[model samples]
Target: MSLVARAKSLANRDALTRVGLALTAAWLLLVLLFWLLGPTGTTEPSGLGRLVRVMGLVLPLALIWVGVSLGRSIEILRAEAADLRQQLGRPLGQDSHGRDAARAPMPAPTARPAAPPHGQAPAPAAAAPSAVAARPRPGDQRQTAMRFEPGQAQAPIDVTTLIRALNFPDGPDDHEAIDALRQALRDPDLSRVLRSAQDVVTLLAGHDVYMDMLPPNPAPAAVWRRFAEGQRGSGVAALGGIHDREALETVAQMMRQDEIFRDTAHHFLRHFDGLLARLVPELDELQIAVLADSRSSRAFMLLGRVAGSFG
Candidate 1:
């Protein structure tokens, strides 16, 4: 069945269940009252009284049966609702699914021309350009005909304007600032800058620039190295100074000391550091020393502070 129909059916079933529960509760209450108020002695024990007595003796049993039956019915309805949900591929809750379905895909409207004013003459269609007539047929090999539709010429992008808009260096290491930079770089007008930003972000992401701006866990270093290679091809300088061991060791040590770097260092160590070390062999020994020193220093400092406070 269609989703709407299934939904309506579920609603109807739920309503019926509520009504059934209310009626059952009322019936049970009435039976209990009748049992509490014994039959009047003045009137002959009416057939209704006899019936009530019999029911009073057996009503509890009947109620238990009713409860069991209702429980089973509820379970069945729940299972049915679940099945309907799976079939509809949506959760069973409020009108959320209905609202989502309504919003999912809009219907294509039929085109209707507007009526002209009472006395106005209809506008004439413009003549096709001479270029259209001079164009070779589709099968011709030499034709360089280009189709230019209305409003096809958009404004050209200005790279200098885009660069000015970037306004970088506002807290250079800020994640939000970097994201904005990346976004600005993506503009088609600044394709070159975008490529540069991509390289920079990739390289920076590999490094521990700031604590919160750490790269993805188990960093994709190989992918990053490949990206770096591509960027260097574009003549963008690779980050960091020399590729020598001492330079790398100093850089690593600086990164370890930077408070922000520690926050994301573990992720780098776990994922990308090994791959990066292999590619830039100078970093291998430096990374190990920096990591060990950073951890021990932090541990000792924390211990000393705690001991001083206690003393």
Candidate 2:
């Protein structure tokens, strides 16, 4: 079934499960009444025959209720499996199977990606192995991309591209998002930030900690400006407006116990911090708010809170 139908089916299944449980409860109540009143006064079946009748009536419903309980547990297990597969860089959905084709990650492009003319789709990027997907640590002594700065590059990617790249592509068919990300990847520094942000957010989803759950208490433009102007610590802490303590604690716990997660989180933080420091100066308040609403920005907010970037 299509995902939309599958989602609706799950919803309908939940309702059916609830109704079945309620019916099972009603049957139990009737059983209690049968025992209390005893079949002496009425035509109600009694003795073993009556017990047989009750069992016949209750068994199917009881079975359904038990199945529903187990189904919920199975769903949890399924979600965790999907999360693990995703973390291992395996495809979670059918669309993800083609993500490598759509992404076409390369170490360096043969030609610089110029912005497509307005309203035209971007040309297909040349196929290359995904270099950014599995990045090496800085300690590996391999140089990584760091070529972007505010007003420094000759052909800077537009804010829309930045926003789209931050959100990343939805799936293989999300051509617009894919194209924007492709454009962003042409810049060394921006690409690293995008990849790092992508890794941490994907990891966070495994913990069932999503960016949307946090009430995005967006800091004012002045607060964002302070952050862009090289302020650090409490002076610009409001930028980390995400206040979901449960999520913060989950990330904090991960940071403590999971060495790999901690390292990735710190790497992502550094890349995002550097990129934001450069990018924000060029945007207005409205644009800043728009950027903040993107998926990557939400991840940054959550991680910053855990890392104490926001006081």
Which predicted model would earn the best TM-score?
2
Task: Kindly provide the TM-score of model 1 when superposed on the true structure, using C-alpha atoms.
Answer: 0.18
Off by over 4 Å in 2: 1-86, 91-154, 171-173
Clashing pairs in 2: none
Q: Give candidate 2's error at residue 181 in angstroms.
A: 0.9
RMSD of each: 25.7, 14.9
Cα lDDT for residue 296, candidate 1: 18
lDDT tens per residue, model 2, 1-311: 22443464577568767877787788778777876896564565559887887687778776868878777666545544554454546322123222221221212212223322111223432322211121111221211111122333447777767776675555555566667777787777887787787667656755656553454566777787787777778887787877777888999998998677788899998898888888888776555665675667888888888888777
Candidate 1 yields a Cα-based lDDT of 0.33
Model 1, residue 163: what's the lDDT? 26
**Per-residue alpha-carbon lDDT of candidate 1 for residues 1-311, written as tens digits (9 for 90 to 100):** 33555576567666666766676777778877876795747767889988987887677656755765676577555655554443333211113233211111112223223211111112422321110111111211110111111222345423222222222222223344344344444444333333322222222222322111111111122323443243323221222212234324433563456343333333333222232233333222222222212211122112212222112
Once fitted onto the true fold, the runs of candidate 1 whose alpha carbons sit more than 4 angstroms away are: 1-61, 64-311
The per-model lDDT (C-alpha) reads: 0.33, 0.62
